[model samples]
Each structure stands twice: as C-alpha cells, then as structure tokens.
Target: MFMVYVSETQPLVDFLRSIKNGSTVLMASYDEPATKLSEEARNLIAEMGSTYVKSLGFRDNWVFVGAKALPVKLCLFQHIKNNDKTNVYENWPEIIDMDGCIPKHME
Candidate 1:
C-alpha cells in the first residue's frame, strides 16, 4: 500500500492537484528545508540505526509531481518523527493514487 503522508507544511499542493489518486507516480528529487516536526521524524529513524530515511531525503521533503498512466506498481510511505516518540511511524501511510496523475503527453 502507498501513501502521501502530508504534514503541517507540504510544499507541492498545487502540483499535486494536477494528479489523481491510484495513478502511477514518479519520485521526483527534493532537497529543501522541512518542518521541525518532519526533521524529528528522520531523526527518530536514524536513532533506530536505520539509514534508509537519509537516502529518502527529509520527511515530506519530496512530493509526487509527475506520473505515467502505466500499470506500474509503486508504494509511497510517509515517515515522520515526533516528540511523542510513540513509534507511530510504523503503521501509518496515507494512500495516494497516481495512475491518473500521468501527463497527457506521456500517455
């Protein structure tokens, strides 16, 4: 199952509006400052001795922009750290459909 975990400060709202859920999404690169809450999410993962998030980039840093109307399978996970430290990152993924997000030209 894939998700589009949104945080307090999602940057690509307008861009995302162009796509539809269940669509095939492309993982565009992102390297911008994230919310303090988002950073804490990455830190939590790091503290657990996992380097996956580092390669995944900052929490909520990357947004789903482009898409292909192919039958490709993709699962997007929204991971974030919080002061609660309740280990809530394990079972939360807001699903985002990407099949319709694909550009017309690409189809």
Candidate 2:
C-alpha cells in the first residue's frame, strides 16, 4: 500500500500509469487537489476504481483506495466530502477518516 497527497496532476498521473498490476494506491486530498487536476488524471483514477474522482472539486476532502489493473469489485473504497458553499469550514471541507482491510492480491 502507498499513500499520496495529490497536489499536482502530471506527476500523479505518471505515477499512476507506471504502477505495476495489483499494486495498491491510497490517495488523500490536501489544500486544492483540483486546481491543477486534469481530465486525463481523473479518468485514469476513475478507471482504477475511484467512483468519486470525477466529481472531486476544489477544497473537497477525498480519500480513496485503488489497485492497478484490478477488478473494480476488488478495490473500491472511497470517501468524499464536498465543500459546503453555504457553510464553509476553514476554506475547505471537513476531514474524513476511513479504516478497512484490502484483501491480499493473488497471483
């Protein structure tokens, strides 16, 4: 498992593409993850099993678990908190916490 705080798109996209099959990826948002995020990056992450990647917006809190080249059913864990425009908190959404076990990948 690897943890990443997305701030840039190219580096993250490159890293996501380079990962080997079955590799687990953990992602968390910090500051503004969408300012520099590209459509390609969002599509790639969505393909990797993130349902919320496409809707991720500015200052939204997001956490996701995914795996390279794996079935979506095997790696589908995510949590998202959209920034509340009417009642903003510290210019960002509330933080999220998640805990679970990812089944070991078999060859």
Number of the top-ranking candidate, with TM-score as the measure:
2
Model 1, runs deviating above 4 Å: 1-11, 36-73, 76-107
What lDDT score belongs to each candidate, Candidate 1 first? Answer: 0.37, 0.71
True-vs-predicted CA distance for residue 71, candidate 2, Å: 3.4
Give the Å error, residue 11, model 1. 7.2
Best by lDDT: 2
lDDT tens digits, residues 8-91, model 2?
467777877898988887887776666567898888887778888888776677788888787644554555556466435756
51 Cα displacement, candidate 1 (Å): 15
Q: Ten-residue segment with the worst summed lDDT in candidate 2? A: 1-10
Residue 55, candidate 2: how far off, in angstroms? 0.7
